[model samples]
Target: MFIRTESFSQYIRQYPVVSTLIALNVVIYLLSLLPFIGDPIRNFGVGSNYMIAQGEYWRLVTPMFLHAGIMHLLFNMFSLFIFGPELEKVAGKARFLTVYFLAGIFGDIATFFVYDSSYLHVGASGAIFGIFGAFGALVYYTKKMLPQLRQIILPIIVLSVVMTFIGPNINAAAHIAGLVVGFLIGLSIFHPKRIISWRKPKLKVVQKR
Candidate 1:
């Protein structure tokens, strides 16, 4: 299910929401690379506890699209690209957007409350973790029916949580918060019944009586 076999055009067509999000991230990242406007864009968009406290509320949402560097952009966008389409397929466009943005905003909100006023962070790791959490919820709801999903999803969650704590300069608070929010949203909204088998049904020929 995680494997993407779609062509570039097909991918864009099939997963428009994911494609738009990836495009937005890339466009914002490119804008941030500009010598003149780059620093300004980052300064304005980055999630800053001080600025947030000072009433710059949009920072929460903006940082979802902002990135500190090309690597940061690539990593987050890649994560979105890989995991997003499936969720989008399951959740539909609206719920998927709700999950993505809410998870990200809540992550920023968590960071705001957890860190001191001097704290500054930029990246979509929180949102990406949110996607992971949504997958976790899928695994949870479908465990009895889809036992194989545990093997596929559990390790990714475990490894991601481990890396979150051990990795330098990582924002554990946002990641954890986003994950929780995503999982909760998933549990509340996602029905196990919505999950359908990806394999094509085989047709059988009946012998004439």
Candidate 2:
């Protein structure tokens, strides 16, 4: 189900929401590389508990699109790329966006409330974890029909959770918060009857005459 065989244009057409999100992330990351405005953008967008306490409320949402470095950007975007398209396909565009943004916002909120005022962070890890949570919910609701999905998804979720804690400089609170929020959102919106029929598209092989 996770393998992507679609051409680039086909993938974009089929999953506009995921494509756009990945594009936006890349654009924002590129903007942050500008010599003049780069630092300003990062300073303004980073999730800073102190700045948030001082009424920079936008920091919560902004950090979802900001990354600390190239590796950070690549890792989060890669996660989103791998996991996001399926959820977007299953959840539809509007619901998918709702899950993505809400999970990210709540994750940042958790960071703001749980961490010290001096704490600062920037990345899309929280939002990506939210996608993971949504997948967990999907497997939970549809496991009977797709019993094999549990075997596939469960290991990923567990490994992700373990890495969240053990990884140095990780934001465990945001990751956990995003995961919980995504799962809850998924439970509310996802129905087995609706998704049970959904299947990965089969790639047609061209025959040589």
Give lDDT tens digits, candidate 1, residues 1-209.
Answer: 88899999999999999999999999988988899998998888989999999999999999989887777788889889999999999888988888899999999999999999999998888888888888899888888887777788889889989999999998999999999998998886665444443344778999999
Off by over 4 Å in 1: 192-209
Q: Tens-digit lDDT track for model 2 on 153-175?
A: 88988999999989999999999
> Candidate 1, overall lDDT?
0.89
How many times do residue backbones clash in model 2?
A: 0
Worst 10 residues of 1 by lDDT: 191-200
Q: Relative to the true structure, how large is the alpha-carbon lDDT of every model?
A: 0.89, 0.89
TM-score of candidate 2 relative to the true fold: 0.90
Q: How far off is model 2, as Cα RMSD?
A: 7.5
- Residue 81 of model 2 has an lDDT of 80
Instruction: Give the clashing pairs for model 1.
Output: none
